[model samples]
Structures are given as structure tokens and as C-alpha cells.
Target: MRVAFVSMTTTRHRDTEGNRRLERLAHQLADRGHDVTVFCAAWWDDYRDKRTIEGVTYHGVTVSPAPTSFAARLPVLLARYRPDVIHVRPRPPRAVFAASSGGTLARAPLVLEWYGDEELADSRTVRLLLREATAVVTPSEMVRTQVRERDVADERSHEIPDGIDFSLIEDTEPGEEIEVAFAHPLDEAANLDSLLLALAELRGRDWSVTVVGDGPLRPDYERQAADLRIDDRITFAGECSQQERIAIYRGAHTFVQTAYREYFARELLRALAAGCVGIVEYQAESSAHELIENHRRSFRVTDPQELADAIVESGDLERRTIDEDFARFDHRQILEAYLDLYRDVQESHGVL
Candidate 1:
């Protein structure tokens, strides 16, 4: 199967969660011997129109992420590429319109990956995109529900979650054993205040924590931790690589998710796969709770007080170096789901 990925910028240019997910999907699909090509704005230094890196080819649609110019040129390029399915996102909005036109020209099914993080400044345009797309993929039911509110049919909207590497979790040696763990980029949306306050609730308990990731708000979070008087027991390890994080998750007994906004609780997934009892705080805008709703060793809370109680309670759960329960979320399994969706859509469209 040939896939034409339409995005104005990739991880190479934007390095966002959504872009990184697309990059992984493209490369993984290519690894399986499928012809995958990314139609994106040029990020390379050279003036070449296209380049192939890691088996997947990238066709530069524009020199930069110029929405107008990128939109104007996308339809013809996609029409020429003639992929079996056209996968895109709703970021630029105009680019989606261009992709729709190109899909119409190529008679290919248009699949939109709605991360639910992008702002919907124009509802009419979003509705049009939702109505026109052959299939709309979201990272979780929280996002799928939002997409369905725009009048998209149930069959047209699908929930495809973030993929995990179960093998990595199994192979990584445990890092410094800690009682509690939390991971997220320390930003305004991180909502680390909740975790800190929760830790404060466990003030007298014999416990320690490791906070991973860093950002502009690191200093603020550090100060908040100090003010809570739990800084002594906390280690703000700063940014750590995936291997480092997996090791920590493996050593820790529990992992908490308190981010104000999460399309998908990726770090929590890693922690859970590494056998950390998941503790998630419920937020209207976050889908973190979704990952833990079905797990026996998990709890969902709405505030720091509840979070603290859950953390203390999780000690009763058995420690595990790995939990095979999450094997379904492996990258290969998720890739197969994508292939299944593509084949199902292609069959409906008579493309295969």
C-alpha cells in the first residue's frame, strides 16, 4: 500500500507530539515494505524537491511552512503521487482543504488524524473536513467524542491510540528505585502543582519521587515543590531519554498523570508497561484517565488530595518488572491496526 502523508511541517521542523507520531507511523509503515511518502514543507537545507531518509521518502511541498503557498501546491502534488490513501492533519486547515481537493482528484480516501490539540477557530471549516474525510482518527475516545460532536458518523470516527515499545520496557534495567514517579514536560499545561500538593499530603510518609522532563516552567515547579516542603524527597531529574525514563518507571512503584491537557497519556503508558501502578487525575480536557479506566492497578482522581490517597494505596499492588497486559499497544500491533483501517477504507472506496 502506498500512503501519502500530508502535513505542512514534520518533527524535523516543528517537533510536536502530533508530528512525531506521524513520523513514527510513516517510518514504521515503510519498514514493513509498504511504499510511504511524506508530503511536507521542506526542512532540509538543500533545495531538492524530495529526499528519502530512513526508507520513507519526503516530498517537500514548500520551502517553508507557508500555509497559503503550501495549500496552493498540495492538491497537484498529492494528485500526482497517486497514493492508495491520503493521510493528513487539520493543523493548517487550508492544507486539509487542499488535501480534500487532491483526494478528489486522485479518487483516494482522505484520512484525517485529529490530535484534538489544535484550535478550532472556524467550526464550519472543521465540520466540512469532518464530513468529507473518509475516516477521522483520534488518539483516544476523549478526542473521538469531540470529533463526533461535529456531526461525524460513528463509523467515520475511530480511536487509534499511541504506540508503545513493550520490548524496551522488558529489557531496560531498573534505575534508582523510587516510591513515586511523574513525567511530563514542565510547562504551564503540565499541572505539576497538583502532583506537588499531592506529595505534600504524603509529607510524613517514607516516600521519594523522581520528576522527569524540563521546560521554561522548571524553576517555578522547583519553587512550588520547595514551598510544599517536599523538595527534600523529590528529585527533579530534568529531561531524560526514553531509556532513562523506562528505567525509572521500572524501578518506581507508581506513576501519576496530572497534566491539564493530554490527548493521550503517553508517559503514563510507558510507566504502566514498565509495571508502574498508574494514578491519573481526571481533567475535562485530558484523556489521561482513559488509559487507566480499565486497569485493576490504577486509580482516577479529580484533585491532589485524591491523588495522594491513591498513591499511598498503590503500595499494596505487587511490583512487576513488566506487565504483558499492554502488549496490544506495541508499535507493531498499532501499525497493524492502521493497516487494517487503511484496507477497510480502501475496500469501501473500491481502491483495493
Candidate 2:
């Protein structure tokens, strides 16, 4: 497949989840013997219009993150490339509009990845883009619903959660016995207090917790833990690598998801993949609960008391080092899903 990816920013410009996603997909497609090209505002230092890095080719549509100029130039370049599929990010809605024109000229179908964290430049433009896009990929049902609410056809929308490195989970041995595991940036939006209070509820019991990640709220969380007198039982390991996190999750019996807002619970996914009994607290602004919807080994709760109750209930569950069920979330499998979507779109558009 000849694929053209449209993203105004790369990890080089802004290391965001949205940017990293398109970047990874482009590279993966290229490595699979597909002709992949990324049309983005120039991240290259030279005056050249294009550059090849690794197996993927990058074609600069503008010299900077100038939305107007990038949109104006994107269509012609994409048309010239003659892509079979145009994979794009759903933000800066004007750019999606431009990519639509490019997709039209190239006889390609546009697939938009909606992480639900994008900064929609305008409401009208976003609606139009949602209506026109051949496929809108969301990482969670929460996002899929939001897109569909805009009157997009059901078949055109899909829920494809972010993939994880399941190999890491399988390869890394359990670090230590962690009865409870919680991983999230100790930031304002991260509802660490819920987990802390829940742990306080189980203070008299025999259990240990490993809280991964660090942020400005770390000191506050530490102080909160101390105040609750459950500080000794909880360890604030602070921003460990992915391998380290998987090890803890692999050892842990229960993993708590208590963040205020999450488009998708990535840390929870990692824990579940490692066989931790998932316990998610329902938050109005968060889509985290959607992950545990149908799973038998998971619990969806409302408050800290419910969180505590679920933790106690988790003790009865068997501990596992790894869960094979999550193999579908592997990066290789997800890349294949993208290929499948591309093939479907191509066949539908008579571009095969």
C-alpha cells in the first residue's frame, strides 16, 4: 500500500501521544514493505523539501507549524505521491479538510486517529471532517461515541485501543510481591487521593503497594500518604521505565485505575496485560472505566470506599505473572489491524 500520513507535528516538534502514534504507524507501514510518506510541517534542518529517515520518507509541506500554509501545500504533494491510503490526525481541523482534498485527488481513503485529546481548531470544520473521513479510529468507546454523536455513520467509526509491548510483560520477571499496583503521573488531574484513601482503608491488612510515576504532586502525595499513616506500606518508586512497571504489575494482585480524566487507561492496560485484577473507579470525565466493561476479572467502582472494597475482593483472586489474552494489544497485531483497515478502505474506493 502507498500510504501518506498527515500530521502537523512529529515527536520532534511536540512529544505528544497523537504525534507519536502517527509516527510509529508510518515507520511500521514502511518496514512492512509498504510505501509510506509523512506530510508534515518541516522538522528537518535543511532547505530540502523531503528527507528519508529509517525506512519512512518525510515530505515537508511547510517550513514551520503554520497551519494555513501547510494546508495550502498538502493537497498537491499528497496527490503527486498518489497514496492508496491517507492516514491522518484529527486536530487542527483545517488540516483534515486539506487532507480530504488530497485524498480525493489521490483516490485514497482517509483514516483519522481520534485520541479524544486533540485541539479541534473549529467546531464546524471538525464536524465536516468527521462526516467526510472514510474511517475514524478511536482508542476507546468513549471517543468512538463522541465521534458517532456528531452523526458519523456507525460502520465508519471504530474502537482500536492503543497497543502495548506485551513482549516486555512476558520477558520481564516479577520484581517483588506488590499486593496493590497504581501507575499514573502524580499530577493534579491524577486522582492519587482515591487510591491513597483506599489503601488507608486496608491499612490493618497485610498488603504492599507500588506507585509508579512522578510529578509536581509527588511531594503532596507522599505527604498525603504519611498523613493517612499508610505511608510505610506504599512505595512511591517514581517514574520507572516500562520494563520496571511491567515487572511490578506482573507481581501485583490488583491494579487500581483512579485518574480524574483519561481518554484511555494505558497504564491500566499494561497492568491487565500483566494479569493484575483490574479495578477502575468511574469518573465522569474519564474513559478509563470503559476498559473494564465486559471483563470478568475486573471491577468498576464509584468512590474510594468502593475502591477499597474492590481491593479487599481482589485478594481472593489468583496472582498471575502474565496474561496471554492481551496478545491482541501487541504492536505487531495493531499494525496488522491498520493494514486491514487500509485494505478495506482501498477496496471500497475501487483503488485496489
Candidate 3:
């Protein structure tokens, strides 16, 4: 099958979970003997032209860095590539344009892969645009519920959970020292301020706490850590590659996701795959709650004291249970899910 993926950016341009997802699906499809092409904005200064990477071809179309203007170029690229299936990743402005234009220009079925909240788009316009898509894919049941509640036709939407590439699972033994890590861009939404306060309560706890990933809120978080008087116990590791992140996850005894607006916590899964006990900030409506409820090895803690308590108790849970659940969503299974979705879209629309 010939598939064309349309996204605002590629993994090469920005090392984001979303970008990595697009790259993974594209490469997996290509490796399975499917013709796959990705259309993205020219996000890099050096590579403004079309090129191919690891069997997946890319068309780096130049457009406004903004999604609104970028949408205009998608149809032309879609018609040119003429793939059997046009798979679009989340970018509201572009989703609107792609769905609208694709309804007319595209001879193949159109699928929208939603990785984030698309609440930014005008609801009326998005509804009209969604009418154009043959299928809409979301990574979690929470996201699927959001799409369904948005009035997208039930038949057109499918809930396919986001998956991790378990190939990166390289677990290091719990060394003499254990580090509890919380990773995300330091920001107001990260709610790391509350987490820092929580960690401060663990003044003499045996474990060290590290915060990986960076953002504008770094200084504020650092200051908060100092105020809590646990600065010495905290270390900040900035953005990392696949291997580095997996290594960190392996080495750590616990992993925390403190974000408020996360759709699906991918990093937490990576940590679980690496045999780290997972702790999530408790939010009734958030994806984290669902994860902890279903996974016995996972815990949800709201206050800093509770967070620290969970970390302290993580040693009691069976690490193998945590590893087993994540292993189920390994890369090979993820690849097969994409293949099935592609085949469904193709057969439904007669693209094949």
C-alpha cells in the first residue's frame, strides 16, 4: 500500500514524542514493504528540500512556520504523492485545511491521527472538515472520548492506543543508589512546583531525585528546589535521545509525570518498559488516572507527601508486572496496529 503522512514537523526537525511517533510509523510501514512518504514543513535551515530517511521519503514543503498557512500546501502534495491512504498527524489549523481540501482533491481515504487536543480549531469548521475524513485515530480512550464528544461520527473514529518502541528497554540494575526522576519541560502546567514542595518533605529520604527535560521554567524550578532545601538531592538532565532516555529510565527506581494537560503519558510508559515503578500526579479526568487504575503497579499521588510516599513504597510492587504491561505494547505490536489501520482504510475506500 502507498501511504502519505502529512504533519507540520518531522522527528528530524524537532525531537518531540509526537515527531518520534510520526517517524516510527513511517519507518515501520516502509519496512513492512509498504510505500510510505511523509510531507512536512522545511523545519531545518540546512535541509529545505525533499529527501528520504531510513526508507521513508519526505517532502519538505516550504510554507509559513504557522499551521494556518501551511495547510495550503498539503493538497498539492497529496495529489502529487497520490498515496493509497493520506494519514495526517495533529495540527489543528492544518487538520482543518487538509480535511477540507482532501475531501475534494484526495482520491484515497483520509485518516486523521490526533495526538493532542484540537480544541483550538473552530468547532463548526472542524466538524465540517471532519466530515471529510474516512477515519480518525486517537492514541487513548480518553482522547477517543474527546473526539466522540466533539460530535465526530462514531463510525469514523477508532481508538488505537499510542505505543512505545520497547526495543529501547535496557534496564540497569537498581544500583547502590536509587534516583526518582520527574521528566517534562519545567512549566506551570508541569506542576513541578508542587512536586518540588513534595520532594522537600523527603529531606532525609534515602533516594535522590532528578528532573530531566528543560524549558523556560527551569530557573523557577531550580529556585523552588533551593527553597525546599533539597537542591542537593535534585539534578536536572535536559532533553535526551532515545538511548539516553531509556538508560535514564533504566537507572531510576521511580518515574513521575507531573503534567496537567498531557493526552497520553508516553514517557511514563517508556519508564515502565525499562522496569521503573511509575507515579503520576492525580487528576480525575486526566489520562494518568486511567493508567494507574488499570495498571496495578502504577500509583497516583496528588500532594508532595503522597508523591514521596509512593516513591518510597515502589519497592514493594513487583517490577515484572510493570514490565509485562509495557512489553505488550512493544514496537513490533505497534507496527502491526498501523498496518491493520492502513489496510482497513485502504479496503474501506478501495484505495488498494
Candidate 4:
């Protein structure tokens, strides 16, 4: 199958989860012998043209900060590519409009992929895209519920979570000092303050935390840990390579995430795959709680105290049976599901 992916950005332009997911999807599809072409905006010097990476072709549409110029050129590029299906990550309204129009012009089925509930709030653009889409896919049921509540492609919408490359993670024995792992772009919304406060609650506990990832708020978090007098027990490792991150996850006894709004908990999933106990905060907007709600070695907490308590209790929890918990999110399973969705769309459109 020849598939064309339309997105505002790619991992080449930004190192965001959404961008990385798209890149990985395209690469996986290409590896499976499906011809995949990515149509995305050029945000950097090296991205301002056509390039092939990992067997997939990427066409960078040059634009200024705004997507206006790229949107104007999308239809022309889509017509030239003339793929069997057009998979669009609907972000900016202009990009959606262009992809929808281009798919129509090219006589190809349009699939809309959403990562969160943000697009559901854009009634006009979302309605327009839904009307033009052959199918809609989101990473979680929480976002799907919002899509349904808003009457956006109720019948055609499907929930397909982001997948992890489980092969890259290696299991390791939990380290001494009750090593706890927490990773996030240390932003204001990350709720690291709550995590630090919670850690402080465990005053005499023989646990230490390794904070991974880095952002502008790292210094503030460090200062808060100092104020709590637990700075000695916290290690600000900052950013780490993928291999380093997997090792950290493998060695930790528990992994905690306190973000207020996580669309899909990618890091948490990695932690589980690495054999770490999972403890997630219950945020109304986050889907992290859904992943570990009923699991034996996983927990959901509402407050910092609860989180603290969960961390202390995590050491006693049995090792998680990873197969039962993570089977649905296997990369191979996700790829097959996507292939099936593509075929179904193609058959429905009489293009199979």
C-alpha cells in the first residue's frame, strides 16, 4: 500500500512525542513493504527539502513560522505523490484544511490521527476534517470519549494507543537505596513540585530518586528538593540517551509520573516494560491512570501523600507480569492494527 502522511512537524524538525510517533509509524510501515511518504513543514536548515530516512521518503514543505505557505503547497505535493491513502495528523487548521482538500483532489481516503483532546475543542475545523475523513484514530479511550461527546466521527473513530519498542528495553534487578525513577521535561505543568514534596514526606525512608529529562524548571525543582532537605537523595541526571533511559528504568524499583495532563504515558509504559513498578497520579486529563488501574504492581494516587505512600509500598509489590499488562501496546501489534485499519479503509473506498 502506498501511504502519504501529512503532519505539521516531524522528528527532524522537533523532538516531541507526536513527531517521533509519526516518524516511527512511517518507518515501521515502510519496513513492512508499504511505500510511505511524509509531507511535513520544514522547520530547520537540513529539513528544507526532500530526504529519505529509514526507507521512508519525507518531503519538507518550506514555510515561515506560520503554516500558511506550507498549507498552500500541500495540495500540489499531495497530487504529485498520489498515494492510495492520506493519513493526516490534524493540528493547525490550515494544515487540516490543506490535507483534506488535497486528499479530495487526489481521490484518496483520508485518515485523521489525533494524539489528544485538543482538536475536539476546535469545533469548526474538527467538523470539517471529520466530514472529509475516512476514519479517525486517537491513542486513548479518554480522548475518544471527548471526540464522541463532541459528535466528531463517532462511528468512524478508533482508539489505537502509541506503542513502545519493547525489544530495546532490557530487564535488570532493582538497585539498592530503593531507586525511584521520574522523567519529564521539567516544565511547570510537570507537577515535579508535588513529587518533591511527596518525597520529602518519606523522611527516613532509604529511597533515592533519579530525575531524568531536563527543561527550564530543573533549577527550581533542585531548589525545592534542597528546601525539603532531600536534595542529597535526589540526582538530577538531566537529559539522557535512549539507552541510558532504558537502563535507568530497568534499575529503578518504582517509576512515578505526576503530570497534570498526559495524553498517553509513553515513559510509564517503558518503565513497566523494564520491570519497574508503576505509580501514577490521577489527573482528570491524563490517561496514565487507565494503564495501571487494576494491575498488581501498579497504582494510582490522588495526592502527594498518596503518591508518597505508594512509593514506600511499591518495594513490597510483586513484579508485574509484563505480558498481560503490555500486550496491547506491543509495536508489532500496533503496526498490524494500523495495517488492518488501512485495508478496511481501502476496501470501503473500493481501492483495495
Candidate 5:
């Protein structure tokens, strides 16, 4: 199958989880003998218009500040590619309109992917996209529920969770200190202040923390740690490479997340896969708690103190077992599901 993926950006332009996931999926599909082409905006370098990374081809569309110009060019681009199916990640409303129009022009089935809780307003543009889409895919049940409640798509909607590349997992011994790790941009929504306050509750405990990722609020978080008097015990490792992040997860004995909103907590899953005892705070917008399997080794806390307690008591619990059956999140399985969806859409729409 020849698949064309339309998104606003790619990992080369921005190192975001969504972009990374798209890049991984494109490569996986290509490795499985499916031709994959990704159409994205030229966000970074202006010199190159097209490039192939690994096995997947990437075509960069020069975006104008005006939405009208960008939307006008999308159909032309899509027609030039002439792919069998079009997969779109809708964020900006104009992009969705463009992809819908382009899919129609190319006579290809459109697959709209909802990755976050995007509140759909009652508008003609949204209705048109929903009506034209061959299938609506979401990364979690929470997102699918939102789509259904908003009447975005009917029985054509699917819940396909984001997957991890388990081959990246490396076996490593746990560190000496009861190292608790959390990786997120040091922004207000990260709720690092809560995590710091929780750690302060265990002042003299033989444990330390490694906070990965950096952002504009790093200085504020650093000051908060100093004020809590746990600065020495907490290390702000700043933004790390993917390998460094995996290594940190593998070495740590516990992983904790206190983000106020996370559409899908891939970091928590990675940590758990690396054998870390997971402890996630319950946030209405976050689905992090859904990943916890073993109640004894993992926990869902409501407050900072409970998070601290979970970290302390985690020592008594053995490392959570991740059996083959639990490894359904493997990217291979995810790709197969996507392939099946492509076939369904092609067959139903009578697209050869």
C-alpha cells in the first residue's frame, strides 16, 4: 500500500512526541514493504524541499503566514503525490480543510487521526471533514470518547493506542540510590512544584531524583527546588536525547508523573517497560493512570504527599512483570492494525 501522511511538522523540524510517533510509524510501514510518503511544513531549514530519511520519503511544503495560501497549495501537492490513501493529523482547522479537499481531489480515502482532546465546535468545516473521512483514529479511549461526544465520527472511528519500539529497550542494573525519574518540559503545566513539595516531605530519606527535559521555566523550578531545600538531592538533567532518556528509565527504580494534562503518557509507559515502579497522579485530562498494571508496584495518587508515600513504599514491591501478552503496544502490532484500517477504507470506498 502507498500511504501519504500529512502533518504540520516532523521530528526533524520539532522534537515532539507526536512528530516522533509519526516518524516511527512511517519508517515501520516502509520496513514492512509499504511505500510511505510524509507531507509536512518546512519549519526549519529552507534550503531543502524534499528528503528521504531511512526508508520513508519526506516532502516539505512551504507554508505562508496566510492560511488561504497554504490551503490552496495543499491540493496541488497531494495531487502530485497521488498516494493510495491520505492520513492526516488535524490540529489547525485550515489543515483539516486542505487535507479533506486534497483527499477528494486525489480520489484517496482520508484517515483523520485525533491525538489529543480537541474540543470540536459545531462548524461547517469540521462537519465536512467528519462526513468525508473514511475513518477517525484516536490514540486513547478518552480521546475517542471526546470525538464521539462531539459527533465527529460514528462507527468509522477507532481507538488505536500509540506504541513503543521495544527493540530499543536495554537491560541495565538499577542505580544505588532509589532514583525517581520524571521527564517533561519544565513548564507550568508540568506541575513540578507539586513533585518537589512531595520530595521535600522525605527530607532525610536515602533517595534522589532526576528531572529530565528543559524549558523556559527551568530557572523557576530550580529556585523552587532550592526553596524546598531539596536542591542537592534533585538533579535537573535538562533535555536529553532519546537514548539518554531510555537509559535513565532503565537505571531508575521508580518513575513519577504529575503533569496536569497528558493526552497519552508515553514516558510513563517507557519507564514501566524499563522495569520502573510507576506512580502517577490523577488528573482529569491525563490518561497516565491507565498504564498502571500491578497495583502493588505501581500506584495512582491524588496528592503530593501520596506520591511521596508511594515512592517510599515502592521499595517493598518487586519490579512489575511485563509479559509478552502485555507487550501488545509493540509498534509491529500497531502498524498491522493501521494496515488493516487502510485496507478496510480502500475496499469500502472502492479505491483500487
Candidate 6:
């Protein structure tokens, strides 16, 4: 299968979770003997042309950095790639226009893989774009419900969970010290204030808290830690490469996810793979709930007291090992699901 990935930007964009996910998908598909090509915006630096990464080809279409929109450029790109199937990742509001434009140009199947509702456009445009999509892929059932309620095509919508690279799980040295880690860009939705308060309550305990990732809210979070008098026990390790982040995951005994809102709690998956006991907030309609509901060894708490309680109860180190339960979201398994979906779509269209 010749698959063309159409996204606003590639992995060059920092703090971009969706771009990294697309890169993983492209690499997985390519490794399985499929011809995968990425159609994306050229980087702002010296690279004004095309390139390749880990066997997947990238067609870098030049667009004005100031005034250009991805929607305006996608039509030209689809004509250039002419792939058997078009996979569109999350984008700005222009994504709806781009999907429609690509659909008209390719005459091939289009799949909208949405991470969250953050990038969605108006209702009319969303319905129009989804109506043209051969399949709509979302990371969780929570997102599927959102699309359905928004009147997107339920018949074409599918749940495809974001994958984790299992390679990062091997040869990891689980640290001897007891430390709880929370890795995410500090944002309002992350609700770090609550986590900080909980951590403050456990200050004198034998546990240390490490906060990873950087964002606009870092200073505020830092101030909160100072006010709580737990600044020394809390380590703010800024943004890191994938390798570094995985190593941090490996070293931690407990992983905390305090997100007030989430599409899918991917970092929690990485924590599970690295053998950390996870503490997450339980919202029935949130992505975190969709993944860890009824799962043993995973803690879901609603309030600050519950989060603190879960963290305290998870001090038993013997039960935190990564077992068969955490093996379900590996990259290979996720890739296989995608391959199955592609084959199913092809067979249904009588193109197989």
C-alpha cells in the first residue's frame, strides 16, 4: 500500500505529540513493506526541499511561514503524492478545508486521525470533511463519542489507540530510590497545582517528585511548589529527548498523571511499559478512563486527597513491575491494528 501522510508540520515542531505519533505510524508501516510518504510543510531552516527519515519519504512543500495555511497547500501536495490512501493527522482549523481539498484531488480514500477536539473546526465543516472520509480514526472511544455527537460519520469512525515504542522498555534499569514522576508540558489542563499540594503533604516521606517537560505554566507551578515548601523535594527536569524521557520513566517507582482534561493519556502508557505504578484522575468520559478502567495495579483518583492516598498506597514496590497487562499497547500491536484496518478498507472497496 502506498500511504501518504498529510500533516501541517513534521517532527521538527517541538512539543508536538501528534507529529511524533505520525512519525511512528509511518515508520511502522514502512518497516512492514508498505510505501509510506509524508507530505508536510518545509522546515523554517535550511531544508527547503524533500527528505527521508527512517525509510519513510517526506515531501516538503514550501509554504509562506507568515500568511500560508496548510489547507491552501494540501491540494497541490495530494496531486504530487497521489498515494493509494491519504492519512490526515490533527491540524489547525484549516484541517477541515485541507481534508475536503485532498479528497477532491486524490479520488482515493481519506482517513482523519484525530487526537482531540482541540483542532476541530465549525460543525458544518467538520460534518462536510467527515462525510468525505473513507474512515475516521480516533485514539479513544471518548473522541469517537465526541465525533458522533458532533455529527461526524459514525459508520466510518474507528478507535485506534496511540502506540508506544516497546524498544524503550527493554534493558531499562529500574532505579533503587523511591521517586514519583509526572511528565507532561505544564499546562492549565494538566492541573499541576493539585499534584503539588498532594506532593507537599508527602514531603518528609522517602519519595521524591520529578516534574518533566516545559511549558508556559512552569513558573506558576514553580511558585506553587515554593509556597508549599516542597521545592527541594521536587525536581523540574525540563523537556528532554525520547531516550532521556524513557530512562526517567524506567527509574521511577510511581508515575502521576494529573491532567484535568486529556484525549488519551499516552505518558501513562509509557509509564506502564516502564514498570511504574500509575496514578491518574478518573473522569468517566475522558481518555484516561477509556484506557485504564477496570485495570489492576492502576490507580484512578478524583480529588487531591484520593490522589495522595493512591500515591501513598502505591509505595509497595513489589507490585509495580511491567507484566503482560501493559504489553497490549506496544508499537507492533498498534501497527498490526492499522494494517488490519487498511486491509479491511481495501477489501471493502474491492481494491485488494
Candidate 2 lDDT tens digits, 1-352: 7889999888888887778777888887888898989888888889998899988988888988988998898899889999889989866677889999999998889898888878766767778888778899988888888888877788999887788988888999998988989999889988999999988988889889999999999999999999999999889999999898998999899899999888878889899999999999998878888777878899999999999999999888888888788888998998888888889888888888
* Clashing residue pairs in candidate 6 (N, C-alpha, C atoms within 3 angstroms): none
Report the C-alpha lDDT of model 3 over 1-352, residue by residue, as the tens digit: 8888887766655676666667788888888888988777775557456777788887766643556656766777777767777887666555546744753576778888776554455776666656667788877778778778778877888876667776556443332234576777776668887677767777776668777788899988888788778888788877877667776777777788778867777777777777777788876456766656777677888877888788778867654413766777787887787778778877888756
Stretches off by above 4 angstroms in model 5 are: 8-16, 42-49, 60-66, 117-124, 171-177, 293-296, 320-326
- Ranking, TM-score, top scorer first: 1, 2, 4, 5, 6, 3
Clashes of 2: 0
Q: Best lDDT goes to which candidate?
A: 1
How large is the C-alpha RMSD of every model relative to the true structure? Answer: 1.2, 1.5, 3.3, 2.7, 3.0, 3.1
The alpha-carbon lDDT assigned to residue 265 of candidate 1 equals 89
lDDT score of model 1? 0.91
Clashes of each: 0, 0, 1, 0, 0, 0
Q: After superposition, how far is residue 204 of candidate 1 from its true place, in Å?
A: 1.4
- Which window of 10 residues has the lowest lDDT sum in candidate 5? 169-178
Q: What does the lDDT come to for candidate 2?
A: 0.88
Cα TM-score per model: 0.97, 0.96, 0.85, 0.90, 0.86, 0.86
Question: Model 6: residues >4 Å from true position, as ranges?
Answer: 13-15, 44-49, 65-82, 90-107, 283-286, 317-319
Q: Name the candidate that leads on TM-score.
A: 1
lDDT ranking from best candidate downward? 1, 2, 4, 5, 6, 3
Candidate 3 similarity to native, TM-score: 0.85
Q: What is the clash count of model 4? A: 0
lDDT of 5 at 246: 72
